[model samples]
Target chain A: MSERPPVPVITPGALARRRLHVMFALDCSGSMRGDRIASLNYAMRSALPELLSVAEDNPEVQVMVQVMRFDTVARWHIDEPTPIEEMEWIDLDAGGETAMGSALAQIGEALDSAEAGPRQLPPVIVLASDGYPTDDIDAGLEQFFSSAAATAATRIAIAIGSNTDLDTLERFMNSPEARLKPLRANNAPDLVKSIKWATTAPVKATSSPTNAPDVASQLALNAEQLEAPSSEVVW
Target chain B: MSWRAGGATAIGASHIRNKRPNQDAFYASPTQQSDPRFMICVADGHGSDAYYRSDIGARLAVEAFIEAISWNLDSPEQINSLPQDIVQIWRRLVKQDIGRNPLPPGFERAPGRASDRDIFEPYGSTLVGVAASEQICIVVQIGDGDLLLGYEDGTINRPLAADTGLHGEQTYSLCLDDAPQRVKYKAIKRTETWPDFVLTSTDGVSKAFVDDAAFVDVVRHYRELVRSGEDLQATINALPDWLRQVSDNGSGDDATLCLASRRYKIQDQ
Candidate 1:
């Protein structure tokens, strides 16, 4: 067989390839200033290598990322589906009120706008906040979950500190089938760990070929302290 | 005219790196008991550490499928009930395996005897199969694999409908809580014409494409090659390498492809 000429096979283009989208909604409001936002930025930047590791680990999926920041209002910090290789995290200055609800609406719209469905790996959304939303988070949840594509996404949250609204964060992390709670980062170490877990676990759970919607829950069950406590409540 | 087939499976790039088992299995058999009889099956084992022994589950699925179809083929009355038979045979096989390979003494348990069905979690697998004779084609499935039949007219039909209840990587499995109820079966009568070609593949093959349409076109391309006189044996021989490339670059998951073609005699032509 080795001696014979190479045989031909069908191959699809990049456009035809499956994609895994991991969207991040960072709270850049005033409370996230100082150690909070700094740690958030540092941790997020450090997560790039691990995320790259995951994308390399699963060659079949094209990992695309988009970042959203909500202060007085929500807007794309890094808009468009940027391939992981081309991604570079830019630090943000915290200012204004928490518009997390608007952030959700925006994230929902992004998922809605995609032409993706079964061919798309269910998206992983991480909501990082250190404070309560000044906007109506409930309405945002309703709007986000209203989109079937968004509803199926693995939405998770990272609580920056003690002041963060556990109730709202829980609401955002809610799932009809998965019992995932927020990942609280008390210090820089916890921030790094939570960020790494958020970046890797969801990709591993969602990218595989035969996983259930609650695959993340199963992973969470095995992980000893996937949801252990208090962040200084950094933004 | 009669149908003949070939199939191949390749381990995923990641599975190899992780030292994990192939976890994908396929089976095909052609028999002369009838004028023309053919059968093919593909099963995908669930991934992740939770389903640790899914590779064994997938292997048993194909084995059970062949046993069930072969035993029931002669009994038309019992053939329609193959969904139950396949699952029953598969569970029984799992039970027997557990008996022979009993867990180590310290293995954790719920402090009671878990029935064979209740303890079948580690063996979860999704199966799709087809049994065909000159008169009809019987298809049965409980998961993500697909079945397609193509004729000379450029029309291709998927005999087993997509299960809308499933989404993304989620699928019904032979080891689910209610596998039999979820199993779907279809028997298509070959009254109009015999399909020129038939293809059955694991979800990995389809997941590699942008959409279902693109995957179907891949099958169409293969059929067109056959129509243009490319040798069947050559294509079959190359299937392993082709599928390996697909798994390495296309889906990064185990891939399986099985196909058959109708051989025509002068009288049939």
Candidate 2:
């Protein structure tokens, strides 16, 4: 009997793809009175082009965008829609009390809703705010991050402008690295680009379930590497 | 032909554009249809406002976006690379179509004058759809609405988020003042172990399934609803009366839904 040479085994690379359900839990408190809201509008307008571009390229990936604006309470600007490419922005109005708890609860409910599908690959929640909670924040956050409904989705927070309670925000994300510090938007252009980055950057793979750990290590390593050469993005 | 898991593509729709006499503005397309790959879904123009063209707007938006994705047909790229590229292109195309900003010459326009049957103004409508293959499920949207999924364990889930806490707050709408930059998406990859059902709908239909906690329960309802071997339309029509009940007595906007599942096809051996 002739013995055949050992056949080689090959395994294809596991495709690392994801479904993005971006719930923008924004603070539309009266404090966010004037240009702040306008800046947000400008930011959303500028960012849509980029958002549409990305959705077009990755057909497997869909985007479900819901805007939960909080001021005295939480209000959604749009119902949940995947591939939010056609999303029209509801210009946020700042009025009423900062019922942060209610806002958080609303977001928690949204996160918990039957409409918000359970994410297998973990959905990313971006909570952008500029102030401290005037209500029972811990309870609301507990509800927000509770593993009751979605055990896999990840949460990321962005604190824009000052007056933001970084410590509280840090607690909400459960990770310091996920927190995006405030960037000063001096002009309309600044507002647009900064908002774009905040909304779009997290959609990238760095914070993804499959890439999170690698991303964390790489970021640290990169930080160390950069520190070796006097840390600063001179370019 | 039919690539969705459920064999036939399921759709649930409701219209509430008329509270007045002599308006009579409502429409749906491919009337009674179920083709998975090349399906065209639309919500018509509510012919009463200045943007009386909105029905056309809704129709055009869904058609335009759907056609764009269907025709692009390129290999799916890395998740990181895809969303950005698609967003950029879609933005350009939409603006160009609106005529506020024109693209370089030769890109196709709907054809005929703005007054023609297929041609209309920057009318508006919200759309959410899914074009799925055996290997991929792509969900698309242009407005406010719900999209839910049923998992293997009889759980129901909505990919879209909803509002909560405090009364009288506004739910988001795909209306004129929309914050386009705030637009974003979450692309999730399906694994052999994860769930395999998709439910896409306009905000009206979506709100019906929104508040529940256990996604599995929702899925259970969906599974139970389909046991009769009914067509997609009838099955959707049988949604709980609350789901079909008009929030504003048929004076509200239209509601639409598209449900697709991923399952093995029982072909004749």
Candidate 3:
């Protein structure tokens, strides 16, 4: 009988990888008709490459993206969770009243186990809004947070411009223990930076093999860094 | 005493971007003609930036486990203390490694968290192992992984209980504060009919299966294949490619499997 090799033959198939679901909730209210909407579109479109890079690195973590837009009513700009590499950003126009509440409710329903497939990793939900919700914000948040998946989701809210409702955004961020504060972007540049950071950083951090803070806390830390320079800016 | 053993470790397809080393490590002690004992250990490093050195940590864990077992072979009471003893040895090794290799800049705290002290966090990894002699088989696990015993009757049984509330992609690790308490231990006394094979693997391997039953089928299939073959070395050589296929078609993660089997005698006509 031939002697067995000293080293075990290592193979590639034993690890069972998982998928990560990332959803974007955008506000397409009339207040965001000009630069705000344009910046949001540009940020979303440009951030794709980075997101795809994350997906590529974490091959085990298949990234699926879903886009939801809310104005007079909430609707799916991209209803299905498409692989990050294949996802294309459809530019959204802003012209109707903000329906943040409806959007949240819709997302909450989708997060339900009955509607969503087997829960993979905790889903990442990013919200970008420029105004107060015109609909029933309380009911919407109640419905959204009711689902365990939604409650456990890594939620981040981006408040565009000073006029945006911080209270609504804060309420939307339900993970108090996570210590995540809403990101406030006062201009187009800040908006772009916040969107890119909010979208990509958490994904990259979570995908890492070490212990990582939940997505909410990660975003909060990034928001603090983004705001640091502004506080130091000398006019 | 007759035993045939082979094992392997490879990088996951998804971790290419970070150029992350394969965080999974395995060790199969060379079969000694006199010892009549077989041992194998497999570990998976936690996949978070905080655990930057988890690849090395995993290697340390398996090595430490094997060493701990060898030193306590005569004492069954020491075997009960194996979990704590192994962790202590692993921590000592990690501390020594850290002394030689300082943490890179900005790794003192976990990324994005100001208060978290992540100095030792990078060495976190999950460990699962099996040590078997002619009369007894022992299984120990800390965190997520699969360990099974295949009987001559073509049945595979998992020696460890399922981890509950460990939802999607989350697993306990040796670096966690409560790791010592979380260690699971099982010992099976060998009967007149010895188990056909003993297999231990990290989560990557088990995640590829559709369900637990399917996992058992794969174990049974491997046992049957090994039992049918005369050239044990050739069969071991062929395992890597088959495992790669399983990973490519299933989870696309780094997959590893280690097998220790008892040699079967062929009947003469």
**Second chain only: TM-score per model?**
0.89, 0.55, 0.89
Model 3, DockQ value? Answer: 0.25
> Which tens-of-lDDT digit does each residue in A99-187 have in candidate 2?
66666677667666633332222455666676788888988877776643323344445455556777776676564354233433434
Please state the CAPRI-style docking class of candidate 1. acceptable
Give lDDT: candidate 1, residue B51. 67
Q: Best DockQ goes to which candidate?
A: 1
Query: What does the lDDT come to for candidate 3?
Result: 0.73
Q: What is the TM-score of each candidate against the true structure?
A: 0.90, 0.39, 0.80
Q: Score the docking of each candidate (DockQ).
A: 0.45, 0.02, 0.25
Off by over 4 Å in 1: A1-16, A176-178, A212-214, A227-235, B31-35, B104-118, B192-194, B226-230, B264-269
- What's the CA error at residue A196 for candidate 1, in Å? 1.4
lDDT of each: 0.77, 0.45, 0.73
Over A1-235, each residue of candidate 3 has an lDDT whose tens digit, in order, gives: 4364322333344334556778899999998998889989998988888889777766666788899999999999999879898888889999999888999999988878433322246778899998899999999999998987787677788888778888888888865663787887777777778888778877866554332222244456556787743432221
User: Predictions ranked by TM-score, top down?
Assistant: 1, 3, 2
Sorting all predicted structures by DockQ, with the top scorer first, yields 1, 3, 2
lDDT by residue for model 3 (B1-269), tens: 66667777656665555577788899875432213678888888876555678889889999888887776565655677888888888888887897899888767666565532255568888888888776667788888888888887887888788765443355777776666777888766666556778888876676665556566677777776667654445555676776665566555556778887776442221
